[model samples]
Target: MNDMLRQIEPLIPALRRYARTLLRDRAGADDLVQDCLERAVNHWSQRRDDNPRAWIFTILHNLAITRLRSSASRPRHIAIDDAQEETFARAPSQEDGLRYRELLEAVARLPEDQKSVLLLATVEGLSYAETAGVLGVPIGTVMSRLSRARERLLKERDGDRGAQPVAQLRRVK
Candidate 1:
């Protein structure tokens, strides 16, 4: 038990980071992490030791899905304070800030599965296999999702598709 805590302690920050990315709400993310720890501690002794990191992540992932589903059935609300707290950028100019915000919105708009894979692999620095185990998906699926996620993010960051320039006509003589 003591050995387990030592190993698990290091992963908490990473877990919180991943949760924050997923939830986009600091309080919600903290709640998810708290729920994850509570569940892990409750089932600590019975859990398999082969991959404790994956197991704990799996718990966090499952709890996030449940919350997302429940929230979907109801109207979503974002407190102004939480939204302000979520931004990490200190913009040099308003244009840069706008671009940064757009990029973040693109990420938040990502499909949940792809978002999870991208955050787990890139943000959390998990190996492909570790991500697969955490999400219970195949390695190929993780690769595929990650690839698609990057492509979509790039596309959104590049342009506003279907946007057209407006034309003005001078007054006729």
Candidate 2:
């Protein structure tokens, strides 16, 4: 019990980083991380020998999927703080800031599956097998999704923002 807690403690920063990347909203990311921690602590005894990082990540991923899937069915209220002061260490140059913002927008625009696969494998530094375990997909599928995600981000960064996104085709026979 204490061992599990100690192990999970070190993962807090990594979990928060992954959650923030997965969810752009700060409050939502914090909520997700909190929920993941709760679940981990609750199931610690049952999962004593398993990989704690993977277990927590899987829980977090599942929770995010459920919320994202149901979001359209519910109305969400967002509170904006108009007077919030922005703070940063060594603020980036204007061009750098613009590029960073563009990268975020591109990642946000990716399909949910591709985005998850990319963020988990790259940003979270998870192996293909580990990402597959988290997402409950085959390793090959994870690889394909990650590859596609990288390609899409590259295309978006190179192309004009005003260009229309390619549409998926549906066949009606």
Candidate 3:
């Protein structure tokens, strides 16, 4: 329906971003989004109206998990072109760009559960309740995972900053 299209159209970019973060491959992410959209359209009648965004995200999250599990044993390959394009899309400043890439690498190193919670809550700006609904986890669980994710990232950033003990100075000279 036109109404459904209008509502779903606006969410495509966010869905794609989440998918790319989860899968770490643009083509796979795009395919996942397409599959999610198809599934959403097919199940629109059954979806509750109270929280369509959560519902849609739930669908995409579930699909992404499934895809990840299925592909866990396979080796991943990235096209050089895609890699170059992504590299060119970052911030112009070398320092900012390096920091951004490091942050993304830190995120990628996170456990799946924590990564999902972090992305849903922070990157997508979903509330705890909404993130909980999308991930089908308790709010407390979401909070715990998010806390761990944040702490881990902070530690990583600190480590990258070369945190070290300062030499003690003599009391008098």
Q: Alpha-carbon error at 51 in model 2, in Å?
A: 2.6
Candidate 2, RMSD to the unseen true structure: 8.4
lDDT of 1 by residue, 73-168 (tens): 898776666577336556556887788778778889999899999888998888999899889999999999999999999877656653767587
Tell me each candidate's RMSD, in Å, in order. Answer: 8.0, 8.4, 3.8
**Tens-digit per-residue lDDT, 1-173, candidate 3:** 98899889989999999999998888899999999999999999999764589999999999999999989989876667667564557465788888887899999999999999999999999999999999888999999999999999999999846567768888895
Query: Between the candidate structures 2 and 3, which one is better when assessed by TM-score?
Result: 3
lDDT of 1 at 162: 31
TM-score of each: 0.79, 0.81, 0.85
Badly placed stretches (over 4 Å) of model 2 are 80-93, 160-173
Clashes of each: 0, 0, 0
Better of 1 and 2 by lDDT: 1
- RMSD in angstroms, candidate 1? 8.0
Return the candidate ranking by TM-score, descending.
3, 2, 1
Candidate 3 segments whose C-alpha is farther than 4 A from its true place: 77-93, 160-163, 166-173
Q: Could you say which candidate leads in lDDT? A: 3
